[model samples]
Each structure stands twice: as structure tokens, then as C-alpha cells.
Target: MMNRRDFLKLACFSVVGTPARSVFDRLTGKDIAGPTKEGQPKWAMVVDLKMCASKPGCRDCVDACHSIHNVPAFNNPKDEVKWVWTDSYKNIFPEQSHRFVSVEVQTRPVLILCNHCENPPCVKVCPTRATFRREDGIVMMDYHRCIGCRYCMAACPYGARSFNWKDPRPFIKKIKEDFPTRTKGVVEKCSFCEERLAKGLKPACVEACTTKALTFGDLNEPNSQVRNLLASKPNIRRKAYLGTEPKVFYLE
Candidate 1:
């Protein structure tokens, strides 16, 4: 009954603390362990709203992520690009809001980033495997393989995906030689700092957060910071009932 995507998710569930590439290798019988069913780390993020709510004007996290990732800024809000940004609580969590809620908290800008869900609908809908979930549980985008169909964007419920409407060269001030810039028509989103993780570094947003509001860690490890936060404080995930099982949690 398991489809290819389901098989990948199943493999991801058993691959903790291992290289992302190993997931594919095991599928091809390249690993000594063969196909594992062990509980592996589901990478996750935690946003401490109690700390982030006060620093809405401070965009260090956004700036760090964007600059390093070569994300261009078109200036127009409707056409602007973003990897991480801020928006009102009501706008981000419309379903969780109530009329009795205070205006300040309701209107307060909160940090918004990709959830990198366990069961990503975008991955399921991608015809070209442009977006797929790695065995380590990170949803990734292969821009070179992307065909610019926008199906992934339409499939994403969080509105996390963005399609480049115009050439980004003019918008990018200083282009990083390392990160590849996407041509117009490709969809992009937050990558959960997979590159940094490969080099044994934390995410740019998490490190740039002076208030220490951002926590990134392996969910499978009970001693991890994100896991500890979830254990001690009540956390909220966007659209939990939708069954996406987002890895990012907000500590309100």
C-alpha cells in the first residue's frame, strides 16, 4: 500500500543523525543497514513568540537568511521575495484567533518561516521532484530540476512558496558567488539552512536572533533544545488539524 513518497517518508522516519544522501543510498541497497525503521531525528524549529513579539522591527534573521541565500528583493510588496519574514498573528494564525483577543497581540508581527512539514503536500504534487523531503525530514527544492509549473506553490497551504515573477539580477544588490540565483519562473522558499547544517552549523536565522528566540534541533533527540522547549512549554503549530505535521512550533 506504500507509494514512493510514503516509502521516502517511512525511510526518513528511521534515519536519525545521518547524512541526507544516505537515505537515497539505502533505498538502492548501498548502506549496510539496508532499509531501516529506526526512529531518526525529525529536524524542527521553535519560535519563542514571547521574545520575538518585542523585536518585530529587528530583521537580523531575515537579512541574514536572505543575503546568504542570494534572495533578491523586488521592493514591491506584491512581487517582493522572502525566505523568512514577519506578519501579524491573526494573518498567520487566522483559524486560532478569536474576536475577544486583544488588538496588540492580534496585530503584533510574528516571525514567519517554512515549517518543513513531515508530510509535505508540495512534495506530493511536484511532477518533477523539484521539491522533495530528505530522509532527515527537511523539505528541499531543486531549482535546477524545477520546471516552473507553480503546482508546488498551489499545493502549499502555508503560502510559503514564492514564484519569481521577474528577473532577480536587478533586485539583488550584491550577489553571492556561492549561492545560485533562480531565474524568473522558479519557485523558492526557506530551506531550513540545509547548507549550513551540512557544514555543522546552525541556521542563519537562529544564530542571528539576539533574543535567542529561534531554536533549531532534532526532534528525535529528547535532550535537544527544541525538544526541551516542547516538553516544558505549550507550543502551537500552524494548521495542525490539516495533518501536514509541521516541524516548526511557536511558543506563545
Candidate 2:
């Protein structure tokens, strides 16, 4: 990891010389912007529809994820901020759509969030290196380094990135002290609770689910819950044809 002094020297604005990086990325530290590290667990989430359907009015997963991440709610659909939310099956999986598909299946909503794609378009278009994939395959956003260019937002096909049009703190009903609240202009989204993972805990959404609707674990381990669930269920990704290789899957 680069120390503060090294980062300052590398990223600091120079009057006479060309800048090596944007003042932001350099100030925020370069290591977080780098490639995946070796031997780290690749995290993935599986949404099981059977259990999800059992809890009709349950918004526990969304609430837990947002509360823990300090995600704000502007309430307007145009400026809505959500790390996890409900989406209709047809909208999420248009490729699989067919005439007169079961009414119940069509109407049933599914959880949607960042896929944390293996080939993340958001990471590719980020000029400031604000968005990068971690060693464990979790795509992260460094809010401090973000320039709010919205290039990553345009690049993302999953509609996962949310830009704060206003300071989000005031809109947050209940704040999580340990979690950092994003300021206006930085893009934010589901991090898969990298903070909790570091402390040997599961993501808040997964832990809060009463019906065990959400399953998360390392994809590398063959016996892991995520992998086992995948093997046991015929699952589908949001856009598997695009080749982004989204880590999130849905079983309906």
C-alpha cells in the first residue's frame, strides 16, 4: 500500500509538471483502485424466489441493506437511491419473457442490486479510478475519489449506480455511525457489505432475512452455500448474454 506522503507526491497537483493522476484518486489512495488480489474469496449473492415469495410484505432485506450502508431516500423515483430494491420479473429478465407466462411469476417481484460483475463496465469507464473491483470480486466505490462525472453510471447496464443529487445525510432517517454517508455528487451502490466481511460478519440484508431468501458466500469454495444453491437451483442472471458475468443470481 502507498503511504500518505507517497500518494501526495504522486497525486498532488504540480504547477510546472503534468499531473500523474487526478488530485482525488491520488489523495484517496491508489491501492483501492488497483486490480484484484490473489487468493481472495469471490463473493456472490443468490436470491431464492420461493422463500422470497413467502414473505409478501417483507422489505427487511432492502431496509437492512440501506440502513447499514447509510443509503438515503429522496422518495422521488427520478432521484431514488437504493442499494437493494424490488423489481418486477419481466423488467429484470426480458430475455426470458414469453406470452402468458404464469401470472404469479410475472407479478412476483425480485430483489435487484449490483451484480458485482466479473467484467464490470462501471470499473472500466471510471477515469478517476473511483470505482474498482476488490480482491474478493466485490466492486467498490471510493466516494472521496469520485468526480461525479457519471461516466460509470452511463457505462453500467444494470442500473446499479446511484448519484446523490443532494447531500444525502439529511434524508437518511436513521444513520449507522460506523458507515460512511455519501455526499452529493459521488456515485454509490451495493458493496456487498465489504465492511462487515472484513469483520467476519455477513451482509446486513442477508442476516436480516427471516425466510432465508438471500444467500451469500464465496463462489470459489465448491461446498459453500452460494455455490451449492447454484448447483441445486436453475438460476438466472440479469444479462448473462452480455458477458459481464454478474455474480448475483435469481431462482424463480
Candidate 3:
């Protein structure tokens, strides 16, 4: 006789190979058509590391993103981050070795944010349609629809998502009048400035980058500036081993 857990696993696996339409119906109580446009704008980002080293205006990008998003500013690790952050080389990518004194990767702060993968595992794992991929290839989170499960956070390899562990209203200061404030108990990540994009503007972070380290454009467009930048510059993605095929690229 099959155990209950094993039986459930088997049942789920049975549906794994089914069409995405059926999967959507089963999970979301509705069927969503796959994207219609074959070559719709697929925005990707490239961070130029050479220009990022001790860069003067680097924080401007982060500040501009936070200012526009109405993200809370609580220092407590539990209630921090929505759009941008800084991570050291060692923290972002720890060296794996048996040697006791491996030369510390010269610590340089890298701006960290959501990669918005072409194939986001977060979208697949979300039981609610709270998190979904947009037609423009941007991964968006609908805070109102979220159930605070944090499954998307666990599924993401890049640690891009943050959860609201407590009420966020108190932490916000001088809130942006136009942006909606996020409530407690939802998973949030960068949206690549979808609102701005809709207004025919670049992401605030990209616009704030004085050194032009951040580049955003349609990866599907062969002649797009971002594609051209990638072609000309050697770039890499975080956690390539996971095969996420992240839209965000980094040029070192």
C-alpha cells in the first residue's frame, strides 16, 4: 500500500507533464493563454562591474528605486528591502574549497536585485497567481493576491525575494504619494519598474546610474542596445548552475 505522502507526490508528478493550460486551471481556477506576441519586449538588465567598483553614484540607483517604490526603511533584517540592496562578493558568491585560508575574493559591493528569469521557478511554485511573469518578461508580484506562503522566496536561487515579517507602515517615511504601500505578509521582489515602463520611461535605477553601469532593453530585439552591450561585453549571471536563464546579466 502506498503511503499518503508518497501517493501525493506521485499524483503531483503525474500532472507535471500535463499542458500548462491544465496546470493553470488546476492551480488558479482559471486558464490563462500563453503569451501571444512571439517577440514582445523581453527586458533584460546588464550590470557593468568594471564601472561599479567604489563608484560614487552607485547608491543613487538604489535610492531612486526605493524612493519611487515606497519601500519601507526598517533596519531590522526582518522588515527590509523591496527593490535594491548591496552584497559583498563573498556573501553573494562564497568560495567553495577545503583550503583553510582561501584568498578572500577582493570584497566589492555589488548591487543586488531580482533577476526576473526567463524561466522563473517562483512563478511555477506559487500556489496563488500572486506572482506571475508579465508579457514583457518582467516577474511581478501582486501583493493583494499573495497569501504569505513565501514559497517563491524558497524557490528562487538568487535570494532576490523578501518577505514582510511585520507590519510595514511604521517604517515608511515621506512615502511617495503615487505609489501604493505594501502590507504585511506578502512576498515582494523587484518589478524592473513596470509602472515606469508603462509610461515609456526607463527603470528608475537605470536612469539614476550616472556611470551608465546599468543597461535595460529588450533581449528579443537583435539590435537592442542591451543585446548589443551583451554581445560586445563579457557578461555573466548569478547562479548559472541552477539553469534559471535569468534575464539579468552582469558584465565583469
The number of the candidate with the highest TM-score is 2
Candidate 1 scores a C-alpha RMSD against the true structure in Å of 9.1
- Model 3: per-residue lDDT, tens digit, 192-233? 999999999999999998887889999889999999999998
lDDT of 1 by residue, 1-252 (tens): 899998998788667536667766644424422232478666899998879877658889999999999999888888888889988899989987898988887987778878898778788778887888877888899988989999988988888888898988778978999888888889999999999999989999999999888999998787998888999999899998988889889998
Regions more than 4 Å wrong, model 1: 1-40
Candidate no. 2 TM-score: 0.84
TM-score of each: 0.84, 0.84, 0.82
Between prediction 1 and prediction 3, the one with superior TM-score is 1
Decide which is better by lDDT, 2 or 3: 2
Evaluated at residue 22, the lDDT of candidate 1 is 75
lDDT of 1 at 192: 93
Considering every candidate listed, which one attains the maximal lDDT? 2
Which stretch of 10 consecutive residues in model 3 shows the poorest summed lDDT?
96-105
